[model samples]
Target: MQYKPLIMGILNVTPDSFSDGGQYCVQAEALAHAQRMVLEGADIIDIGGESTRPGSDPVSEGEQLARVIPVIQALRCHLPSNLLLSIDTTRSAVAEAAIVAGANVVNDVSAGTDDPRMFSVAARAGVPLVLMHMQGRPKNMQDNPGYRDVVEEVLTFLVERAEAAKDSGIRPENIIIDPGIGFGKRKEDNLRLIADLRRFVATGYKVLLGASRKKFMGAICGETRPVELMGATIATTVLGVSAGVSMFRVHDVKPNRQAADVTAAVLRT
Candidate 1:
């Protein structure tokens, strides 16, 4: 499962995802979309039950499991076996159930700090874990968020998290780090992240860049529509790719995949 600069497609199963709310909440539609992404060149399917966007409400454990389990099971049954599955949630219970249902990875936005058991879960399941850096809770992450030095702060947070995960039995190669562009950032901070992405990668973990229709993209393009953020998102992807990002968690699977192909052919040489 060595993903060297792979594209991890975003599949939000929640009813209110900012990117595509309720688009694939239904079991059949979710399966169809998952298959579509796979066909479009998604190396990994990252299924998320809870929306971690700014001002988002929390989904209960039962709702989270209900939203994610069926989709994971259906995809595992219908999609190719080699197609990787990454569950996005902070609850240990949900991660456990998703792994049992067929998730090969755990993508915790809280970076294993929220659920203490996530480290053990990844260890037991023997799967990769994505650690994302978020300053505060999702509800108020976008409100007056400030950092003395965004890059250094995020880098320190990720370093501490990686040490903790290693202490909890998660292997070094099995760990991935995400800068969390929109989770709690202003325009300048997000831009700084895009520019300093290589600094984070120098920390020695696979970097996963998740800039799919984020708020900063909207601010940059002067567009409120999430879909319109695609072009700016591509620009950031190009920058991140040049900075040596290991994987991408994105919504536009086809374009990102195509862009990644070009990037791999041209830049990563």
Candidate 2:
């Protein structure tokens, strides 16, 4: 099979996300952005209602539902039936509601740690579950993230969570793991994770890289604005493709999709 990585377009419908916050908060805007991404070759659309930016406060489940469910419903009806919709939420209730509202995947950044019922909800829905490795709550995750070995620690954490999900009845093949770049990681830590992504890939579960326009990219490339980091993001996507990453969750779909495709083509040759 060709090694083309899946491109997961990010659609954060919150007023406070780090990047593109409030850009698609309205139903019409969200729908339009999603359509554009789909046209740009997004294999999946990850819709997030809450802002998980560093030092951000959590949104209530009711508020989250209000923000994301209608968007999911609209996207479900408007987009192709085969295009997967992923609800990026940590709360099981919100995940369940999104699933009922038409989402096909559960992307929990906390990896079933924030809500104990998350795995059960994914299992019940029989949807693919994304279990990410976040060191702490978004409010204080970046306060001072420390790890003896960033890659090994995150890898171990994700593996244990995957096992827990399997123990809770979630099928093994449906589980995907994310390293949670920038969520609770320092610049060096984030770089290390991206560089050593193959370790996570070696774990056998599909590995997702969400390093889209992250702060560390800015710190390295000297671009403070998130939107300006599309090139940097594409660089990471290409690096991720070479590292055997299966999926890329990104804000800019077209460029990263092109980069992944080109890189995969070159690698195959």
Candidate 2 weakest lDDT stretch, 10 residues:
1-10
Off by over 4 Å in 1: 1-4
Candidate 2 local distance difference test against the native:
0.94
lDDT by residue for model 2 (1-269), tens: 77779999999999989989999999999999999999999999999999999999999999999999999999999999999999999999999999998999999999999999998999998999999999889999999899999998999999999999999999988999999999889999999998999999998999899999999989988889998999999999999999999999999999999999999999998
RMSD list, candidates in order: 1.5, 0.8
Q: How many collisions between residues are there in candidate 2?
A: 0
Give per-residue CA lDDT, model 1, range 1-269, as digits (tens).
42246889889988888879889999999999888999999999999999887899888999998889999999999999999999999999999999999999899999988889989999888899999999898999888899999999999999999999999888999999999988888889988998999898899899999988888778767899998887777777777778889888888888888787787678545
Error of 2 at 259 (Å): 0.3
Model 2 segments more than 4 A misplaced: none
lDDT (CA) per prediction: 0.89, 0.94
